[model samples]
Target: MFINFIWLNVFLMLCAWLWVSYNKRAGLVDVIWAFGIALNVILASLIFETAPLMVRVFLAVASGIWFLRLAWHLLRRYCHETEEDTRYANMRRAMGKYQHLGFLAFFLFQAGLIVLFSYPMLALLNIPMEQWGSSTIIYLVVAAIIMLVAFWGESLADEQLYRFKQNPENKAKTMDQGLWRYSRHPNYFFEWLHWFAYPIIGLAAGVYSLWIYPILMFLFLYYVTGIPFSEQQALQHRGDNYKDYQRRTSIFIPWQPKE
Candidate 1:
């Protein structure tokens, strides 16, 4: 399973490389990154064929919805924007002559991340339904509730931000409305919540190590790729407005804004 996972990412990364080489838009890698995880879920279910049919189907549907929405949002942004995202553009400028190599490295790094995020799904799908026992019902209920809430929260956050951006009056202003008021990164908060659903489901299947999935996801979002970069970009673009938002709002977990 590990070998197949590596090979699948390698192929996906190669495709991303070719696409970026032709279009010179390295930002498309973000879209590819989402789809890669969706594909991983489907492939893992098919290749393993050990987990309960219902479990596999539910996972595929849940993850598919999440990734597809994310991918579509990113794809539209990529299509409409004339220039690369500032994040990748900055990386390109920093790399100078080694920009292409840097992008390749970035793509590969994201591919690894896809595999890492898929661990809980892989673990859950390997456990057979017969072994789930009575706790299975509890697990499924908890997982389903968490996943639904998290997905809905994320969608709402994205929608609120999108609508805010669409308004001319909101330009250069900090978003302190709706979910954004409670947390500076409500979207990331809910995204991290989504990972917990898997481990809860895995727990019912007697998979102990699945806790690592949410832990890794939290670390990645909090300390690595998610909040740090987003806040940096916000600070750069929105300046004092964003700083004020940061002063009053929670960074990851949603809470009432500070007084």
Candidate 2:
């Protein structure tokens, strides 16, 4: 089942690579990746009948809502923006003649990451119901609450940024209102926060490896793909305004702005 799931993700990402190559819009990979994960979760729940029905249902519904919302949000942005995202544009420029091949590798890497993050869900489904402890209910409740908060925060942050971008006057200005005032990347903070819920949920099924989700997400968001690229782009476009925004706002976690 797990091997089949990996193959499914690879197939979907391969299609995404083809679409991106044609459109020269690598940003759409994010949308496809999110949808692919949701699809995989739904399929897994259907196939893994031996798992606890309640657990399966919770995983499917929660993951479906979270990932689908993100995918739709990204899709809307992809439709609105005429140019490739600066990050991917930069990568493509750096790759030059090998850009297509490079993106194929990048897309495949995303597929591998999807599989890695699915570890918690798959582990839970393989565990017998009788193995789940009494604390399972408590964990589920806590996980649900965390997921809700993370989802709401991410949605609100994205909406705020989208509306800010829609205004012609705001084109070169840094967004520093609402959630953006507290964190430079509130959306990313919420994204990372949501991963914590999975580890907590995994605790119910004795899946220690689930902790890797949040850790890996933090590493990628903070250092690798998320903040570094975004900050560089912002500095390039908005110059000192973005630098000042960075000074006044926390990079990931929400906090009181600097005076």
Candidate 3:
């Protein structure tokens, strides 16, 4: 099953490479990455065919909604924008003559990450319900609540940012209202929070190692792809305004802004 999943990701990476090569818009890979993981989870559940029907159904529904929403959000922005996203554009400039190769490597790296993060889902699907204890009910309740809150929070943050950007008056200004008042990347924080549900669910199923998914997610968001590049871009665009926002706002955690 794992081997087949790896091959699926390889195929996805190849397709993303080809598409980026043709479109020269490597940012679309984000949408592809979301759908790729959604597809992987659905496929894994079907191929395993041993997890409790309810568990598989819940996982599919929850993850499917999350990924589809994310894909649609990214696609809408991608269609509206005339240029590549700043992050990918910067990467292209940095890669210079080897931009294609660099992006292909990046696409493959995302593919690997998608598979690695799906470990919790894989673990959950393989655990038999017979192994679950009474305490599993508490974990399920907690996981469901966390997932709902994370999804809603992320959606709100995105909407707020979108609306803020849409206003011409807000140009060159920092968004320090709403959730952004608390965390510079409230959307990212909630996105990371969403992963907590998976590990908790996996724990309920007796798969403790599944905790690695959320931990790795935190590292990637906090250190790798999420905050650092975003801050750099913000600093480039907003300059002192963004710097002031950074000084006053939490970087990742939601907290009362310092006066």
Query: In candidate 1, which residue ranges exceed 4 Å CA deviation?
Result: 128-130
* Predicted candidate 3 versus true structure: per-residue lDDT over 1-259, tens digit per residue: 6888888987988897898889888888888788887888887777776777767887888887887788788887777778888888889999999988888889889889878777778778888768766677687778889989999999999999988988989999999999999999999999999998888877766777767777888999999989998899899999999999999999999999999
Off by over 4 Å in 3: none
lDDT of each: 0.84, 0.89, 0.85
Off by over 4 Å in 2: none
How does residue 235 of candidate 3 score in lDDT? 93
Relative to the true structure, candidate 2 has a C-alpha RMSD (angstroms) of: 1.3
Per-residue lDDT of model 2, residues 115-172, tens digit only: 8777777777778877888888899899999999999999999999999999999999
Worst 10 residues of 3 by lDDT: 128-137
Q: Give me the overall lDDT of model 1.
A: 0.84
Measured by TM-score, how close is model 1 to the native structure? 0.93
Clashes of each: 0, 0, 0
**Which candidate has the top score in TM-score?**
2
Best candidate (score: lDDT): 2
Q: Write the per-residue lDDT of candidate 1 for residues 111-134, one digit (tens) a residue.
A: 898887777788788887677757
TM-score of 3: 0.93
